[model samples]
Target: MSNAPVYDIDPATFWADPYPDLARMRAQTPVCFVPQLGATLITRRDDIFVNEKNVDVFSSDQPQGLMTVLMGQNMMRKDGDDHMHERRAIFPTVSPKTVKNVWKAQFEAATARALDRLAGQDRADLVKDFAMEVSAEALKSITGLTNMDWREMDRVSQGMIDGCSNYAGDPAVTAHCDDCTASIDRHISERMGALRSDPDLSLIAVQTQAGLDEAQMRANVKLAISGGQNEPRDAIAGAAWALLTHPQWLRAARAGDISWLQVFEEYARWISPIGMSPRRIARDHDLNGIALKAEDRLFFMFGSGNRDETVFARPDIFDPSQDIAPAISFGAGPHFCAGAWASRCLIAEVALPMLFERFTDIALVGDAPFGGWAFRGPLSVPVRLR
Candidate 1:
């Protein structure tokens, strides 16, 4: 040990290439507490899985925790029985039956509209326009805020989360900001008062009818939009970027002998948009031989775990043939991502359709910059999309 009181885990490494730093961390100390980062960093899948189930040890209840502040106590932010109950209330809405009956067709429609906007363009910033547009629209439908301009909301929310760290300027009073989230709050205030009866499919109705209040409903709605905002866009952008960069995979996808679902599994693993989801301890805890006090934050490196040499062979390379269901990129345990189906739907219905239907070859034209701590993905992916 260098006796360095702190080592600021160079976050920018995640932007350039997260794997190298992750590899170094896993090798040096899989459970090493980085004082600079203000928490323990679990480098293995088993550590994260064990801690997730043992929520008493992990303590997900802290108010200042990332989940508390951003997403609130819908699911990922809480522990034990209460967490289970809260999660179950709205969980039915995302079920396969619910999705097949409701979410999928609407999602495909949104996909069509988004791809229509990009039809004749030779070059496109997939991060800004296409990916974000489709993500915003899909979330809007899922949450029953269909009338809102989801595209702008997605953009602003993205800018805001990216603003969480390293905005490099006055983030508070920044007039040009407040981005998508400000709109969400505005929408809630404007509409929540007027709509005495909730829409049939609204996320609010799903939970409120299941037994919640106006305040709790507001938390769920805000959580739905804010936390749900960037995922589809990031997943799609990163997947498309993954395919574009790896021509061999694209060829395989286009060749089309295997089912599309299989292609998507490869896409999800290969891109792995959300490298980690950060969590903070609600109380004192210990696991995997590491002990921690209350209020200590931990970063669950999902990407690192996916690439763990113990589990994955040739972990660095982007391979479509591997069994990625074992991976935790969409999270695991009780806190698994609710938007996973929608995320996968976007890739299948929107991204791949545009890709397979339109162009022959796509190439990455420049370096891909990433944003956010928990929901990290390419910020702007420039490509020659012919």
Candidate 2:
């Protein structure tokens, strides 16, 4: 075991191809202090699970952090009964039943519409033209912000994500986030007025009915936009990139021999979109012999855990047939993403297959470089729709 600090991995290299570095860290220093991140990177699958499950020791309610800065104090940052209550308040809106029944047709239509827009293009950047557009449309429907421009919605969502992921507090990122927050405030206020006059079961309306005040409603709505919009967009692009790179799996997926759900899960594990989640240490504790101090930031590297050799056989391989356990891409325990079902429905069942069906012979134009420190996925997937 190398006792060296894990900050040796360069940020640029890790962003480009993280699997090798993740494998090395998981083997040598699964729970080492990273000076760059100022957090103990928990890379092993079991350790990540333990950290997530033991929320009392590793608290989500950090006094100051990126998530808190961007999302405010929403259900994601809450603990214990408060978390449960707030989660339950919005659970019905994104429940699997609700997503499957209410959002399924909408997702399919959005996917088809996105593909229709790319019909004549000899070469298209799926990330911008398809994935982002479909995800924006879905988010608009989910939040009842259909009147908002999809391009603006995409820009705002990306800004929020980039700001949160920018651990160094980039000025441009902060400005973008500030702008997004102002826009969201206006949107929420308008929606509140509309709901007062006449209400439907959108996410904002449901949260309002569940007794959230204006501030709480705004925070949760921001959370919804950041998580709901960004992750699914990346996942859609990542899944397509995955299948495109590994054509056999793509064929299997199309042939019905392998389920789309399986392909989605594999793509999520292979290249997790939301790569890591932060938790504040409530007290000094020892995790696998490493002493962690109070208020120490702990990052559960879901992307690393997904490829943990101890838990996953041929961890680096992208094989959908293997019966792998559920990845922590959507997180675990109380902080598990409330919009997980909706995200899966949008990406795996609707968007991914829709792209393949529409462009039967789509080919990658060039390399698609995946990026991000906290959130990981392809920046763009340029494809030729022949």
Q: Clashes per prediction?
A: 2, 0
Provide the TM-score for each candidate, comma-separated: 0.87, 0.96
In angstroms, give how far residue 247 of model 1 lies from its true place.
Answer: 1.6
**Candidate 2, residue 371: how far the Cα is off, in Å:** 0.8
Using alpha carbons, what is the TM-score of model 1? 0.87
lDDT of candidate 1 at residue 266, scale 0 to 100: 63
User: Tens-digit lDDT track for model 1 on 258-357?
Assistant: 5456666665554566666666665666554456666676767777787787777657777777766667777777778776776666677556666556
Which has the greatest TM-score? 2
Q: Weakest 10 consecutive residues, lDDT, candidate 2?
A: 1-10
How does residue 9 of candidate 1 score in lDDT? 66
lDDT values, one for every candidate: 0.67, 0.83
